[model samples]
Target: MKLTLERSALLTGLSHVQSVVERRNTIPILSNVLMGADGGRLTLVATDLDIEVSESVDASVDAPGQVTAPAHTLYDIVRKLPDGAQVQLTINDDDRLDIDAGPAHFTLPLLPSGDFPKMTADGFTHDFTLPASELSRLIDKTRFAISTEETRYYLNGIYLHSKDGLLRAVATDGHRLALAEQTLPAGSDGMPGVIIPRKTIAELRKLIDGTNADVSVAVSESKIRFTTGTVVLTSKLIDGTFPDYERVIPRTNTKELVLDNKVFASAVDRVQTISAEKSRSVKLSLTDSNLALSVNNPESGQAREDLPVNYDDEALEIGFNAKYLLDVAGQIEGQDATFMLESASSPALVTDSDDDQALFVLMPLRV
Candidate 1:
């Protein structure tokens, strides 16, 4: 295979695909990127068995052929080449690749293109389109709550469901849950709920962040595909059922408190400084129009802060992880956040005063 591509264009395409390639792999071919040159363009493809990414860039093709080369090494060589310089790539003796720029040249071993695994586009049931900004917002708000526990494999991905004409993404890690919704596209009906793995979501986020175009999504029982412009990504979905999250959200709670989001978040961050290392719990004492946050640790110290709130409920004191509270507060886009509680032992429902599409449920801790 022989091709000539601009230094910046080649580097940009390599940067995107190299991230999908694992740093270490048992199979040697899995560590190299498959390069295909045809139709005056060069396509770079990489995969790690679970996720696959492909990107194409305009290049001057001297011959139509394909080859596999080390992903990271090729990326590093092109990255150090002089800016705007044209790059020449050639495969000689069917086993080595020669790279040449203005004054620098390098040769590297190549693997047969036939050894690269083929990712088939089969059995995709549903297809839809969503704005890049909207998708990014949904991922940014809920990705923090994704569970990392290996035993609970079902909770490691964000659950995407389409019901009642609204699309929702839900994620949780046993201690806190985040649920966000956006209107479904025109033809997104009958789309099955699927759990997208954490790695896939992260890769999709990076791809979306680089462009403003709309992203097309295709889903099936086994895999999920994302395509935008000249880039495409396919990932294997986690084959497990997500927990029924709706049942966990509290439906009825009489006591309520409304506090400024910024003020509440700042207070919790400060009070947590003295919280115990094992259980980062902070106590919230509520009375008529006043709220107090305090944390006492035997090994460390104690901290207390007061804030004015709009609550007239009976006196209540609750304990919660300071980090969890801060995460929920940061999700509140509005100036004020509303918290409904039944008692110190029950879960708290948090929502913004202006938005009803997103909600957070936080489990309280025993101090």
Candidate 2:
């Protein structure tokens, strides 16, 4: 294929697609990116079997054709080229690609375009649209709780579902759980719930960076796809069923405390410094109007912090992994957070005082 594209345009598209390509591959073609030139535009595609990303950019087409070239090498060459220079790429009869930009030139071996695997758009059962910012917020808040354990394969993804006309994303790693909900869009009714794999969520998050445009989502039993202006990401869905997260959320807590989110988060970080090396546990001693956080380690000294709170319950002491509590606190958006506690052993529910859309549950860690 022969085409002339601006350095900035080509580099942007390459940066997005090359991240999906692996450095080492058993199949040579899988290590390369498929470049198709037609209709005065250049489309780049890369896949690692589980996930695929495609992006198109404007280019001056001299001879419309297609070819596969080393993804990382081509990206590096274009990245090192002079800014604002025009890039010309052409495939010669010797199965090599010649790249010319200003005073620099390079040649790389090419693979047949036919060898690249094609992703099929099939069996999509539901579709929805949402602003990129809101979608990014949902993913960011809950992704930390997604499990990395492979044995429980189903918990390795965020569970997207519709409940009471609300669209929610829930994730849990057995120790901590995050649940974020937003008002469902008009056309999101009857959408089938699916577990979106962690890789797909991460790649989609990168593609939506600094973009305010609307993103279209399509999902089926087997796969899911997210599409924006000129970029599309498709991936295979996890087959196992996610556990019933609703059952774990506490509903009968009798004690409540409201504290500044940032202050509480900082206190947790400080107290955890003296916590046991492996357990990372911190003890919370709550009084009628005071909250004290303390940690003691055999090898290290002890730390304690007291903060005034708005609680009137009887004095209670609870122990939890300070790291898990800090992670949940970071997800709160507003200044104040509400914590509802039923007992020292039961799960505690935490949420922003002004917003009920997002909630977190943390299981107590034995100290």
Regions of model 1 farther than 4 Å from truth: none
Q: Give all candidate RMSDs, comma-separated.
A: 1.4, 1.3
- In the range 305-358, model 2's lDDT, one tens digit per residue, is 999888898998999998888888878889999989988899999988666788
**Tens-digit lDDT track for model 1 on 1-367?**
8899999999989988999988989999999999999999999999998999999999999998999999999999999999999999998875699999988999999888999997887899999999898888788778889999989999999999897889899999989999999899866778889999999999899989956799999989989999998989999999999998988899998899999999999999999998987789999999999999999898888899999999998999999999889888888889999999999899999998777889999999987
| Candidate 2: residue pairs that collide | none
Worst ten in a row by lDDT for model 1 = 184-193
C-alpha-based local distance difference test score of model 2: 0.91
What residue runs in model 2 are displaced by over 4 Å at the alpha carbon? none
By lDDT, the best candidate is 1
Backbone clashes under 3 angstroms, per model: 0, 0
**lDDT against the true structure, each candidate:** 0.92, 0.91
